[model samples]
Target: MRITSKVLITLLIVVAITACFSLITHLSNESQPVGDEIPARILISQTPLSTPLFVAKKLGLFKLHGIDITLIPCNGGVECMSMMTHGKAQYATISESVAMFNSFRDTDFSIISTFVTSDDDLKLLALPRRGFTSIRDLKGKSIGVIKSSASEFYLDSLLLASGMKPTDIERVYLKPDKLIQMMKIGKVDAISSWEPWGYRAQATMDVVNLGFQGMYTLSFNLATMNRKDETSHERSKRILAALQQAITWIQDHPEKAKAIVSDTLNIENNQLDWMWRDYVFRLSMTNVLLANLQLQARWALEHNLVEGKQPDLRSILDRSALQAMQDEVVGQ
Candidate 1:
């Protein structure tokens, strides 16, 4: 009886200790703040326009906001949006024009915020050898552009501003890299593209800037699918918070931010300096974005770029995440 009692007492004590240990562990876990465990894959184009995103990743701001981000680099926003659409990524850093173009077909994604804007990002570069020294020189000339992209829109806008129409020029639809190569070989007289392609073309070839400016403002925006779930909304808010931090950091530390961009993009300091002047990095949903979308939609309709009625431009914006951050969603 004595031995049995001793054994029972040992078993009881073991059970009590195990229970106490488990309880302690459970309580400890409950007390600890959640770390950076929220995984997000953001498709980013390799361009200076994505400076804030580059800053966020370089400075680990995303993790600080409880987001584990994997930035997948692509050639441009067009490809980034395509990858996001195919579910290869959960988010994309795309130009608003790309979103506008896609809105005509499927309003599957919603623009979360416009993180950066620039009036001079897009330019008309002409090969002087091709007798293309001005915007008027583009008439009846072969111009390389990424069809259905901001490149095309910029080209058309420049043409309209020059009192010309799209029908007057031969648009050689090509990817950005191909456009550069085609221009070098004299296949295209001019290329309507955004930086750093324009910067790149100038570096590699003798090209003349057509001096087109202020025809359109390009905005780099964060876009994701229209997910209405609370969890998704929370995740988006976290992302916006991180990006907002990055934007603040960039503004406060311009030189450091420029260095980060220069190193990450492998762009020369002079090149960075050249393009950095035009970038206005911030988080906002202003009348500027709205007006641009409406104009693009009308242009798309007029040009038969997309079939059917115009997409309600306002519907494609999901400002819940921005609103959560008290972001500057102006004129909405």
Candidate 2:
């Protein structure tokens, strides 16, 4: 009887220990991304910024990294950042300025990487008949700009760069896509915008490049909402890893990469060729980018673009996912 009671007690203890471990294992599995899990959602702007993302989707790079992506196409970075701001989407491809502007409202957001720098991507085009061949020529002419966008601010930068003030020129507000058509018809003397609209306008309208001053280039960045969940963090790292790989593939195969972007967007050959030169794609956030962000933030503040009194540079750059990915690569 004594032996029977001891055996039963020992069996009960073993069963309890096994059950505890089993429960732990189950919870652990639930926290990690499953191989057959649904695709992670990312809001992407329809621009060169999303070219690599499209390539990744086409090449199955995201799936290779165990991150199936569902891309929600947005017209511009403002809309893209809005999705992140509302928590409707966790990730987006946005302009450094757009991200910087929105970061004022939410500290939970961060720019993980700056993937492209535009040199001459932001261009100033003049109507050929206007004979406005330089930025100085636009001193008193009305310029078309997309209000509430980098277009408007960049026009200010262009003017300031040329020793002119915003007050020196009248600003005509127009959407980026419509700027070209309006300019072609003489609606505005000059238009300031980013590619491929800039490229498209120059080509279609016999417009002259007043300035390819995209030298003070607007950069495009990958941003996300920083979540506390381990799963979310893990997924973010995977997304970056996949993007890094896609960028590598893009560099090594320029023609192929262009084809991917062109085909996806159904772009004309000339437009694709011309606009492609303006983009320099890579993954990084440099001092130049930081400085640009700061400058733009101040511009936004002065323009009443944000409610915050000042910019928060720290909140804008949450590199935790980037650092985590680097550590993982090192570990591997």
Candidate 3:
């Protein structure tokens, strides 16, 4: 009887210990952060506009927010958008102009958020020795621009603003680096492109800035495939959150942020200093962005850049991620 009682007591104690261990393990697993099991690839351009992404990756903010990000480098937003469209990356950083041009043909992706905005990012650089000292000199001259890009749009806008038409110049379509090279070799009289290409052109060759600042406001945005599933929605939120944190850190530490951007882009610190003040870094979907898209769409249609009737621009925006975080998503 004594042995039986002792065995029964020992069994009960063992069962209690095992139960406690199981409960603790279950709670521990439940308390762990979710969403790090899968790695996410984001296509980013080698520009200061993508500073937040660089900062976020460098500081491990993505991991802090439960996401693993692999940054894929691209030449420009157009390339990044293309890579994202082909399923090469889960996300891409693009300018609003890229989104606008694509919205005419496809609704396969959505602009998740606009992380940065700058009016002076796109510049019209001219070769002074080629008798191109002013914006007006671009007339009848070969101008290098990236077709279907903010570079093209800004060039057109600059020309229009300067009382010249798009047809006034010979449009030399080329990649950003090629444009810079063409400018260096005097192959093109002027090149309208975004920084750091613009900065690179000035740094490498004797180029003059035509000084058409504030002609266009370029929004650097995040884009993902148009997925409305729960998984996609959650993933978007995680990315935005990580970016928001990065933006905050950037605002708090401007010098450090600039250093990070300079290092990431392999550009000189002076280049960043020249354009740092032009950029407004934050996470928002504002009325201004919507209106800019509408304006760009109108420009595209007027210029025959897109043939069909303007697709509903609002449909291309996925604000659920921004809204989920209680962030300000103004103007739909």
Candidate 4:
């Protein structure tokens, strides 16, 4: 039968619409954004700080599950965060303390999951001029810090323990790496920083160590996002699961774990090992940590860090995904 021009046009239009629908369905079904198929680009700091996540990616854990992670070199956590905030990247690793402090202050971000934290990681180093051995000696002395960041809060906690307020001592804001040089030149009386800086000072300058661990009650390096809801939650779960696997491997095969980290960070095996021991990963969150976070929120509220209203503590944390992953990990 000969088809009319009108029918031919209508049939063509129907075919085009059907084809478009089919293509969209196929793409949606096949494009797994969670697991390893994530399209979100990730940026990490240049330092060895993000070694575990790097190890997970290098080991094919991310790819095996379909995660497409783009690792960009950044100067530090704050820099990585800037990349995320500016839309240069989707996610970045940062200390939970930083996120909490910022969130308290109504900063624009949400916590995805936690990374590594330990009691042995932070140290307070004294300059040669001050000859400070205890937190008390830090009184009236200028201490270098990564101000308004997690590092600052860690130092504040240390000071508070010593009966000193933030106003009691002058804090000089500097990058972690520059503190040592500043100390050598008498630019600052002391420095509070994490390893490499902590270890570097001990090895190079014999910087007196005051009794303080970078350890906080709830230390977490979270995967952050500006978006919230099911999709982000699912992605966060996959990332946390991958992190948990990496942590488990680190615990079971300490030497091999060191090698993985060393390779990822491009650090010497010995240095990696030293750094490895300093980190503790329990892969568990607790009420105590929640309480601490609430305390942090309260502090921010009291100090006007957050907006006029405070956020719900329970709503801020989505630990259900982590719990499910933990169950699976434990089962295996």
Candidates in order have lDDT scores of: 0.86, 0.78, 0.87, 0.68
lDDT tens readout by residue for model 1, 178-266: 98889888898888899998889889888898857777888999999888887788788888878887898899999999899999999
Error of 4 at 71 (Å): 1.8
Off by over 4 Å in 2: 1-38, 303-307
True-structure Cα RMSD, model 2:
11.1
Q: lDDT of model 2 at residue 310? A: 71
TM-scores, each model vs. reference: 0.87, 0.83, 0.87, 0.77
Cα lDDT for residue 328, candidate 1: 33
Determine which window of 10 residues in candidate 2 has minimal summed lDDT.
29-38
**If both were scored by TM-score, which would come out higher, candidate 2 or candidate 3?**
3
Q: Each candidate: RMSD to true structure? A: 11.0, 11.1, 8.8, 12.8
Better of 2 and 3 by lDDT: 3
lDDT of 1 at 247: 93
- Colliding pairs, model 4: 36-65, 36-66, 36-67, 37-66, 37-67, 96-220, 104-306, 105-305, 122-214
Predicted candidate 4 versus true structure: per-residue lDDT over 16-81, tens digit per residue = 999999999887753334433665577777555676677777676566445566778776676677
- lDDT of model 4 at position 161: 82
